[model samples]
Target: MTTEKLFPVNGVELCAETFGDPGDPAVLLIHGGTASMLWWDAAFCAKLAGYGRYVIRYDQRDTGRSTTYPVGEPPYAMSDLATDAVGLLDALGVERAHVVAQSMSGGIGLIIGVDHAPRVASLTFVSTSPGGDDLPPPAGGLPHISTPDWGDPTAVEEYVVRSIEAESAGVFDEEAARALVRADMARAANYEAVMTNHYSMNFDEPKGGSFGELTMPVLVVHGDQDPYFPPAHAEALQDAVPDGRLVLIKGAGHGIPEPLWDEFLAALAEHTESS
Candidate 1:
């Protein structure tokens, strides 16, 4: 069973759900921009819990049931988001956690690893780049392009389906995506904030440390067919870290494809256990 609660962190309320025993090692699942904890499915969390990990997934500010700002007016910077993660750990009384982050959150993971190294046991970056001018840009342009009518839930669902279809190359369940999106729209405090605020947030670069300074075990997992950040980005990320490894999901895309869940979970279990 999973327990849901609201936490006061970084002067904002963040809705977080936890699976498995608190006595076990903790895994913090951080979603990408414009996403909530729903992106990290309950079943997936359960599987990680089954691996003897206490898994925590939360809604970032401006997403899900967490705090929100007016459309296009996010009061915090990207670095603030990273600090939020650390604040959440402090609130939870967890001194250290294995951080698994996807897409934009991967950058957040890097910041946390560099700035708050003592709070993290390991780092898992999925479907995101380490950000350098030399890295190859996302294939076929950037993602999250199709805008839908915010008032129309059906339009929003269809838009999500279309976005997934474009971003993925492996097995995708359209109905499942729709069901999740439906819940997301229904539960969101402000659906417009979910769609627009993240894109406009100021991104203050991390201070004092670089990726090469990360001493913890870092795992870079990327879909071979990921359009947003290609395989080369994963390679570059892996190469940047002193102790890093890469896992390429075959025929996968920017998101974690259901068909590759087993492989992803196994990699995660091993990485966290060894770390």
Candidate 2:
């Protein structure tokens, strides 16, 4: 069974869930921007736990049941988010954990891997890139990421579905996407804050140290068909890190598709166990 709790970390209450035995190696799963822990679906966590890993997924501030701020006025920066991830491990009494991060949270993982190196056992970055001017640009611009109406859940859900369609390279599942969006909408303290606050975060400074500085076991997972941060980004990231390995998921885009979970899980298990 999954155990859910609210942890007070970095001066905020973060809703977190854990699976499997605590004594097992811990894997911290960080979702993308404007996403809650729900993005790392429960079934997926259970499957990872089945591999004898202590899996952890949490709702970051301004997402799901965590803390919220006034819309269009966030008081924190990307560095704060990175700090929160480390603080969470402190609260959980986990000395070190294998960090599995998706999309925007990959930067957070990079920060932890570099700045708070002692707290991370390994890093598995998914659907993200190491920021560099020379890397190839995305296939196209991201969809205009604005939720039209917070009061209308249907409208918000439709926007999410459309956004996924724009970003995904695999087949789109309209029914599943709407269901997930509705649950997020129903559980959020402020849905508008969840969707818009991330954009307003202060990113004035760079995130983490250089990719070459990461000393831990590093795995780069990317979709060959990713529109945002194409496959080349993954190659560049892998090449930058010493002894880094890359797993290119065929037919996947910016997100991990349900049909490809096993492939991801297998790679993740081997990486964490070896680390």
Candidate 3:
């Protein structure tokens, strides 16, 4: 694997990791809210690379090793976040690639597919909901991952560790879990511009109408037990996209990359390869 430093939109520097041959078809993996690229397990990325894909995973702004908030400007909108993805691809000289995203990142991916259609070859949405008034909020008081407060170092560290543990309780490998928390802490220590991005930018419109303009293939993967975005949301995505297909993973939850690693990899490989 190789790591590349890229400057996407808004002059934000993004830390991107790549696997497989650069000459192969590319698959961009966009993580969920408050999640770093670490959310996409290394084993899963390797598996996708094994399927002859050039897999790329990057930290969105304010999440990992990426640029954060500006000094005076307000938080960025979801459209800006989507534009960031496009800018990253442009910076990396990637004309078009497959996109796989989860949760909030899924909404961003939908925007990319709609607004930047030529740049997206295929889309794989995992454990994501169509945002808007129709989509219900998460049951608990889960902080929106996109707008974290990195002001208090100690508190941020503790929050990162606890959040990772709580979310990946029984699913993640113990060492992997520890490493993820540590990575988050390290990133938070250096970056404190978390709250500069708007969480409600895309919440205004349902993800339905956007898909009407997307011509690329789409695959919706959701866990039957997904707490945040239940199976119904996946069904809604399927209903919206004329060519989209939904796959329900048994006994899996919102964290697909953790519990449903193999299944997720298989689905992605099959979907990205087929016509």
- What is each predicted model's overall lDDT from 0 to 1? 0.88, 0.87, 0.72
Q: Estimate each model's TM-score.
A: 0.95, 0.94, 0.82
* lDDT tens digits, residue span 109-193, model 2: 8888888888889999999988789988878666676657778877888888888887888557878878888888877988889
Error of 2 at 221 (Å): 0.3
Go through the candidates in order and give the clash count of each.
Answer: 0, 0, 2
**Relative to the unseen true structure, what is the C-alpha lDDT of residue 57 in candidate 2, on a scale of 0 to 100?**
94
**Clashes in model 2: which pairs?**
none
* lDDT (tens digit, per residue) of candidate 3 on 138-255: 5475545433456666566555555654454245466666677676656642444442343533343324457667789999998776667667888888887768889898877676
Tens digit per residue, CA lDDT, model 1, 1-275 = 43678999999999998888888889999999988999999999999999999899999999999999999999998889999999998888888999998998887898899888999999999998878898887786545656888888778778877887778864678888888888888779888889889889987766857789998999999999998788999999999999789999898899787778999999999999833
| Model 1 stretches astray by more than 4 angstroms | 141-145
Q: How high a TM-score does candidate 1 get?
A: 0.95
> Global lDDT for candidate 1?
0.88
Structure candidate 1, residue pairs in collision:
none
lDDT-wise, the better of 1 and 2 is 1
Where does model 2 exceed 4 Å of error? 140-147, 204-208
